[model samples]
Target chain A: MHDGILTIDLDAIVANWRQLAARVAPSVCAAVVKANAYGLGMVPVSQALWRAGCANFFVATTDEGLLLREALPQARIVVLGGVRPGREQGFVEAGLWPSLFSLDAIERWLVATAASGTSAPCVINLNSGMTRLGMSPQELQRFIESADAERLDVKIFMSHLACADEPGHPLNQQQLTQYSQLVPAVKARWPEVVLSFANSSGIFLGQEFHFDLARPGAAMYGVNPTPALPNPMRPVVSLRLPVIQYRTITEPSWVGYSATVQVQAGQRLAVVLGGYADGLLRRLSNRGEGELAGHRVPIIGRVSMDATIFDVSAIPEAQLPPIGEAWVDMLSPVLDVNLVAEHMNTIGYEVLTNLGSRYHRNYVGGAS
Target chain B: MHDGILTIDLDAIVANWRQLAARVAPSVCAAVVKANAYGLGMVPVSQALWRAGCANFFVATTDEGLLLREALPQARIVVLGGVRPGREQGFVEAGLWPSLFSLDAIERWLVATAASGTSAPCVINLNSGMTRLGMSPQELQRFIESADAERLDVKIFMSHLACADEPGHPLNQQQLTQYSQLVPAVKARWPEVVLSFANSSGIFLGQEFHFDLARPGAAMYGVNPTPALPNPMRPVVSLRLPVIQYRTITEPSWVGYSATVQVQAGQRLAVVLGGYADGLLRRLSNRGEGELAGHRVPIIGRVSMDATIFDVSAIPEAQLPPIGEAWVDMLSPVLDVNLVAEHMNTIGYEVLTNLGSRYHRNYVGGAS
Candidate 1:
C-alpha cells in the first residue's frame, strides 16, 4: 500500500464516451460497463458516463448487473449473459434485463415469471452470423411462439457482431445481412420491441448496426473501438508504481531472478514495484520498455513476481527519482497501458482489467 | 460467486517442490514465496513447503518478507530486492535480513542501523555476470574493506545466474567462473556467512551453481523449471466457469461482438462467463479451444469482455448442460491451466498469478 499505485483518468474516459457517441447516428448510445468496464473500475466509469448523459448500461453476468444496479440506481441495466437457471429470481428482483439467447432460457423465464408473478424486460439475442451465442433464425421464430415470448415481456431483440474490429473482414457484412433479415421477422412477431446491437467496434461500422440502441464497451474504457480509425481512443488508465530502489550495476553483474541481464560498463538499475502479479505480464521481461523521466528505459533482466529491473543508465539526461517515487515522478516515465499491452502481445483491455488490486487506486477527472 | 471459480491443488505444488529439490544435492533448498508464491496463493504454498521440511524462503520486498514472517515465524526469510533507501529501519525493526547489492545500500544500511542503535542482518548480493543488480568486482572489493561491512551484520553472500533456464547457454559457465572467483574473496572478507546462488533454473544446472542455499520459485508453483525435462512437473491450478447460455445458430448467423465469426449451417454455441477480464486473453477467442463433454469445442467469434463463444456442435453426441450448469460439469471432464497459458502465449505462471480476484478461489488438497 505504501508503494504500488494505479492512477485512472476518468476525464479521458468521458471524452472517449462522447467521441464514440458522436460516431453513431440517431440511435441511443449505451455504455457497456461489463467486466468492470474493461477493468478500469466500473462504478467510477458508469457514474462518470451517467453524468455525461449516457443512459443505458450492460454487464456480463447477473452479478455484474446487480453491482451496477446498486451503484447507478437510476440507469437501465442489461445482463449480456442471459439469465441462468434459478438466477432469474434475483434478476427480476433487481429489475435487470437478461439477453435471452435460447428457447430453454425463454421457457425457464416464463416459468419463473409465472411462479414469481414478476415481469422484467427481456432482450432476444439472435445469432446473426458468429456461432458463439444467440438464437438462430428458426430458433428465434420458435422463441416468438414460445410460452415466454407469448406472455409478452420482451423489450429488445439483439445480435452481436464478430468482426467489427477488422473493418475489411467479410464476416461483418455477411453478419449485417443476416441480422437485418432477422429484424423484420422479430418485429412482426413482437411489434412493440426495440432493437439493439453495435458494441464498441460495431458503433464504428456506421449507423447500419446501430439500430434503436448501441452498446459500446471497450470504447468507454478508451480502447479504440474502431481499430481502422486514423486516430484511435485515448488511454483512460495510467499504471503508476513506485521506484523501490535505484542501484548502479557495473559490468558482469546479473539482475533479477536468473540474473539474465548484463551491464556492459557503468549502468544504473531502477527496481520498480509491481510485477506479473500486478498485471505486468512476464512476457514484458526482456521485450518490454517503460518511460522513465519521459525517456524509454528498456526493462533489463527477468521480471520478478513483485518487481522489475529497468536499465536507467542509458537515460543520461534523465534524473532517477529517490526511492519510493511515484511512476509519474520518474525521470523517464512509461505511463501508457496500451504500450504495456503491445509488449505483452495483448490489447489495452487486458492490461486495464487484469490490473491487480494491490495498487492504491486513485480515480481522477470527471465527477466524483 | 456462483460462476467464476479457480481450484488450486496444494499437493501438486508440494510434489513439484520435492521434484525440484531432488535435482539438487548437498545444497539446501529454498522456496521463492515472492509475488504471492507466483500467484498460487502464498500462505497456502509456504505452509505446505514448511511442513515438507523446507526451511528457507525468499521474497522480493520488505513488505513481502514481513507478511511471510508472520505465517512462517521461524523460517529463514530473505528479501531478494535488497533494501530500499529509506526503509531499512523497518526491515531491521522487524528482524528481517536483506540481500545487499550496492555500496550505497550497504552504507545506507550502516547509517540506518547506526541511527537506530540496532544492527540488521544484511546479505551481500554480488554482480557476478548479470548486470541488473549487485556489486561490481571492484565495488565488492571496496565493500570488503569498508567500515560499513565491518560494522553491519552481514548474513549471506550470493550471486545469480543469467541463463540457467536455457541449460546450455554459455553465460552459465561464465557466471560459474565469475561466482567461483568471488566466493573465495567474499569468504575471506566475511568468513562466517552463508551463501546462495542457484535459482529455480540454477538448481538444475548441476551442483556448481548451488552454494549453501538454492532458491526455487517457478518450480515451487508446478512449472517445469526445466522445460526440456522428459517428465515435467504437475500443474497445480485449473480454471473453470459456468456456461451462461447455449444457443443454436443456423447458416450465415454471426455471434459475439464485431461479427468476427459466422455459422456455416448448424452450430451450437456456448457463452461462457470467463473472458479477458477473467484473464482469458482475447487472442484466444478464435484460436483457442475449451473441452466440453469430451469434445474439443473451438472458440468462435471475438472474445468479449466478460463472455466467449465456443462451437459445441462437434459434440452432438453429448448433451449440453442447461443454462447455469457448471462449465466444469460440461467439460470433457478435464481442463489444464497450462493449455490456457499456451493459448495466451504465456507460461502457466502468468495465467495463475494474473487470475483476477473476481473468482471464487477454492484451495484443494489436504495440508501436508
Candidate 2:
C-alpha cells in the first residue's frame, strides 16, 4: 500500500476489556469510547466490546453517542458532554444519557423529559476536586433539596479522578474522600444510581477507587494506566509505513526541511510515507526510532508534512529491501506508543488521540 | 454548537491565492491541496481555487489526487508522492500526474503506460537541495539515456526549496543555482515540459525563483510564508469552542489531570469543549491563552482529550456570559494559526493539518 496501515487488534481490545471487567468484578466496567475511542474507529471498537458482553459505553458528545447507538442498539450510551438545552430532545428520544454537570442542566433535563412525556436517565458529574466539568458540592446540596430534582432520574453518579494515575498523589485520596462523602446522601436520594468512581488509572489505584462501576479507557487500548509499573494489557496497535524512496548519501548533505541535520557520505536514508500530519508528532523528528529487520533505525532531521526520513545505514546493503517492497515499522511492540509519547513530551492518551486519519486503518481479529 | 466550530473562510483562501498569484505574476500558481487542503476541506478549497484561475493542483498521494479529480475534472492534479508499481492503473485512469522521483519509479511508469497503451503526463522531481526526496544530479543523467524514459511524457520538471522560508538560509540560492543548471537540459529533452520551482515561501524569495509554475500550499491556507515579515495572506480559519462548564475555586486547588496547575480562592475557570484531541496541541497547556469577552484567559494545567480549561478570573463575574452562552477563541484573526504554531513549537502547516475531525466544520463564502 502507498499509505501507512494502522493495524488495530480488536481481539486484544476485547481481551483488555475482559481483563479490566474481571479486575473490577461485581462492579460493572463501562467502555469509554470518547474521541472516536481515542482515534481507533469507535464503531468497530464499541461493537467488539459489546459482543464481549460489555453494556455501558461513554462518549464525549451527542454525535458520538448517536453514532455508537446505531452500532449497538441495546447498549447503554452516555454522552459525557451534556446535551444543550435545545439538543435535549435528541438524547431523550434516542434513549441516550447526557451527563448533567450543573443544577441548571438538571433542571432543563427534567423539563425536557416532562415535555417529551417520557422519563430517561442521566449521569450526574460531581466535582470531586477535578475542577473541570462538574457541579460543585454547594450546587449538589441545593440539588438534593430541590422539589424538581425528584422528577429527574440520574443513573450514574460519575466523578472523574484528577490524579488517579499517580498512586501516591494526595489528591487521589482527597478526591475519594470528597466523592465518598456525597455518595451516601446521593445513594439515599437516587436509591439505585450506579456509582462510577474509577477511570482507567483509578482501577489500578486499588479496589477502594472502584465503587459500583469502573470505566477504564486507555489501559483497555494498551496504554499503561499504571505508568510506574509494567504494562498489564496486551499491545493493541501497530503501524507500518512503506519506504517510498531510499538513497545513498554519496556526499555530505543537509537532510529534510530547514536543513536540521547533516548526514555524512556513505549513509543510507529511507523516506517513509508518514509524518507529523500522520500523527507522527513533530517532536519525534530526530529523537524517534523505529524497528527495521529486527534492528533499530533512527529518524534523522525534521519530519515533513507527508514524509519522515530514517537513517538506515545500520542495515546491511545486501539485506536492504528493494524500493517499493520495503516497509518500516513505526509502532511495533518494541517501539510502542508509550515510548513515542515520551519522545513527544506528552502522555499516551494524547499519542493515541493524535493518530492521524490518513492511514489505511485495519481492524483485525474481531467478530465478522 | 455543542462541539467546537472550525470556521473556514473559502473567500479568504481564494483571496490568499489571488495575492500569491499576483506576487508571482506571469508564473502559473498551482494550489497544493494535500493533507485535506491542510485540514480545511479539500473539495471546497480546490473548487474555490480552481474558480479563481488556478489551473494546477497538487496532492500528496494517489488517493488524494483521485478525490480531487472527482471534485474538479478539468484541473491538473499532480501526486507529489509517486505512485507505486501496482497502483499505476488508478492514477492513469484518473489522469493524475504521479511525480516520479527515482529512475526505478520512472521505469515502472513507462511499463504501466505501455501496458495500458496510453500516453499521460508526469512530474519529474529533482534533488536540488532538499535531500529528503527526488533524484540526484547523476540519476537525472542516467534517466536521460534510458530508452524507457523517452516514452514517458514528463510534463513538469519540479524541484523543492529547502530553506525558502528563510530567504537568507543560503540553501535557497544554492538550490536555485543547482535547479537552474538542470532546467536547460531538461527543457532540451522535453521542450513542452513546464519548469517549476518555489513553494509558498519561495514566491517571496524574489521573481528569479519563479520559473514557470509555483505551487504554494501553506500561505494559501493563511500560514505566514514569510516569517520575517508581517503575514501577507489573509486569515483563513477561526475556531470557537463552546464553554461546557464554569466553576469557581473556593480554596487553593489543583487543576486537570496530573494536577499540573493550581488556582487560589475566588478564581473562575471555563472549560472549553475542544482539547488536544481536537488539535489543541498539549504544548498549549498553561502557555496558551484564549480570548473571552475582550479579556485574555490563560489555559491552566494540562489540556485533556476532549476539553481544555481557561482561567477566566480576568473577566468580571458580572460580565461572565451564562454557562453555554459564551464561547472562547483558540484560533482567531488576532490569535492565528501561526501564533498557535509558535506555541506548539512547530510550523503553521502542522497546526493546520492537525486540526481534528470532531469540529462542526463551517465553510463560508465558497461557491454553492
Candidate 3:
C-alpha cells in the first residue's frame, strides 16, 4: 500500500563488490557508502557489505561517518568531505578518520589530535587533475617537506580520477602521470601509508589504477562502471509503483499536468501512485517507459507531483491490471538504472542518488 | 559542522496561504500539504496553516493523510491518492477521507465503512478534460444515477485543472466549462457537498474557477502560480552549502567528473559539500550559479553525488571567508527555487520536492 516498492538486492551489491575486489586483487578494496550508498539506504547496505568482508567504508561528510560508525562500530570509516572547523573533536571522539584536502585542514586535524590526546590517522586527498578538491602535486611536495607533516599520522595518500569513466580520454593518463610523480615523496615520508587512487570507474581503467587501496561507490550499487562495455554487475535495485487509478479514454483528450500530451478514445491509461516527487525525475515525463502486466507502456504527459500516467493500451484488455491490484515496474534487471539515467539525460549515479524516500524499501539476498 | 543549512521561513508559507485564501474570499481555502508540503516538512507547514484558520488539508497518500491526521487532529485531512483496497480500514479507522477516482474505489470505501460501522465521507474526482485520472463526464452522470450513490456521503466534488498554470491554454476554459455543467446536478444530489476546482495555479485562473474549496499547493510554498507574471508570494526557503575545499587554480586544469570543463590558471574554486545527491541537479553542471559573500560564482563542472565545484575567483581574497567558514548560497530570495528550476530545466515543484534530507533544517517564523 506504499507509493512504490524499492527492492534492493543486497546479494547483488555484495556480488558486485566481490567481483570488483577480485578484479583489484592484492589491493585493498574499500567500500564507498556515501550519499546513503547512492540513495539505497546507507546503514543496511553497509551492514550487508560489512558482513560480506568489507572493513573500510568511505562517506561524504562527517555526519555520514558518524552514522556509519553507529551502524558498524568496528568498520574503518573515512569522511571524504573532511573535518569542518570547530567540528574536529567530534571526528576524533568518534574514531572517524577525516580526509584532509588542504594544509589548513591538516593543521586543524593536528589541533584536534592535540586537544583530544588521540592519534588520529587521516587520509590526504590530492588534486591530481579533478581541480575540484584536495591539494595539487606541488602542494603535496611542499607539505611533505614541511616539519608539520611529520607530526601527523597520515594513513592514506589518495587522489581521484577526473575521466576514469572514459578510458580513451587523455586526461586519464595525464592525471595518472601527475599523481604518480608524488608517490615516491609521500612514500619516503610515510612508508606504511596506504595509497588509494581508483574509484568505481577507475578500477575498469586497469591495474595501473589498482594501487594499494581502491574505493568504489557507484559500481557496487549496480551502476555500469564500464559504460563502453556491457554491464558486468548484477542489477541491484528493482522498483514497482502501485497503480491507483485505471481508466479508458472516453474521448480524444489531453493527459496529465499542463495537458502536455493526448490519447485517443480507444487508449487505456493507468495512473501510478509515484511521480517526480518520488524520484521519477520530472524530465522523464512522456519519455520514460514502465512495465505493466508484462506489456510495455509509454508515459503520456508531464509527470505530476504524486502521480504518473502511462498509456497501457498495448496490453490485451484481459491483462489490464485492475486499479488497486496492479503495479507497474519502473526499474528491473532489463530496465536498470543506466537506462533510466540515459532517459533522464544524467548518469547512473545521479539516478540512484536521486531516488526518493517515499517507497517501501525491501532488501533481499546478502547470504554471501 | 554541517554540510549546509536549509532555512525554511514557515511565516512566508502561512502568508502565502492567507493571501490565496483572501483572493478566493468566501470560498474555503484548503491547503495541499502533499509531498511533505512539497518537501518543506509537512507536519510543521500543516500545523502552521492549521493554526491560521485553515481547516481542510489534502495529502498525496493514505500514509501522508494518516500522518497529517495525527499532526492536526481536528483538521480535515483528505487523501488525494485514495485508499488502497485492504488499507481502506485504516482510512475509515483514522477518519481520513479519500478521493475516489472510480466507482470500484467508491464501493471499496463503502465496504470499509460498513465493516467499521462508521459513516465515511469521500471526494469524487472528475476527469474533466484531463485523461490522467477519474471518471469521464458520462460515467459521472451514470454514477450519480446509481442507487449506491444515495447511500454514501460525498463531501467534495473535485476535478483537477490540467492547464491552469497557462492562462491562455484552451483546456483551462474547456475544463471549467465541462465542470460547471456538473455543478447543478451534483448540487441536486448533495447540496452541502463542497466543490474543489482549483490547485495552486488554478486559483490564478480567476474566480469562476474557484468553487467552494480552493486547494493551493505550490503557490503557498512560494512557487510562482502564475508562470507568466511576476511572483507575488514571499520566498519560503533558502539553502547554503559549506565550502570544504577552497583552492586557487595554479595551472590550466579540467574540473570534476569526465573532465567536461576547464579552468584557467589563477582562478579560484570552492568545492561545496552538497551536490546532485543533495538536490543540486547534475544538469546544473557548468550552468548554475551560487552566491558567496554576496558575490555570484558559476559552477565549474559536473556535480558529483556529494560535491559541486564553484569558480569563486570573483571574490576578493581579503573578503573571502576562510576554508571552513565560507558557505555558498544555492537558494535565496534573489536566487529562488524558480530561478534554480529554470537552470535545471524543471519547475519549482520539482526543485522543492527534490530537496534531500541531509542538511540541517531550520524552520523560522510561523507567527500570524
Every model's TM-score: 0.88, 0.99, 0.99
- Relative to the unseen true structure, what is the Cα RMSD of model 1? 3.6
Task: Report interface Cα RMSD per prediction.
Answer: 3.4, 1.2, 1.1
Models ranked on DockQ: 3, 2, 1
What is the per-residue lDDT of model 2 for residues A64-172, given as tens digits with 9 covering 90 to 100?
Answer: 9888888998999889889775788888778999998987788788888889998758999998898899988878978888887788888999899988889999999
Clash pairs, candidate 3, are A11-A365
* Residue-by-residue lDDT tens digits, candidate 2, B53-140: 8889999977898889999999899999889768999988999999989988988888888889999589999999789889998899
Model 2 misplaced stretches (Cα beyond 4 Å): none
TM-score of 2: 0.99
Question: Per-residue lDDT of B1-368 in model 1, one digit per residue for the tens?
Answer: 47777777888878877877777756678888887777667787898889988888888777788888889888888888777767777787777888877666777888888888887678888766665456767888877777666786777888877677889877789878877887776787678878888887788788777888888887666665676763267767766778877665444565576555567656667778777787677777788888765567888877766777788887673477655654832111144655566677777667667776667778887388
Model 2, retained fraction of real contacts? 0.73
Chain A TM-score per model, please list them: 0.93, 0.98, 0.98
Which rank order by TM-score, best down to worst?
3, 2, 1
Q: What DockQ does each candidate score versus the true complex, computed on alpha carbons?
A: 0.48, 0.77, 0.86
| Cα lDDT tens digits for candidate 1, A1-368 | 45666767888888888887787756778888777777778898889989999988888877788988889888888887778787888887888888887777877887887787876468888777666667777777866666556685778888887777898888888878878987776788778888887888888777787888888877776666755554477767666666656666434455665555656557777777777888777777888877776667788877766777787887662476655453632111234555566787877677778777667778898883
Residue A344, model 2, lDDT: 86
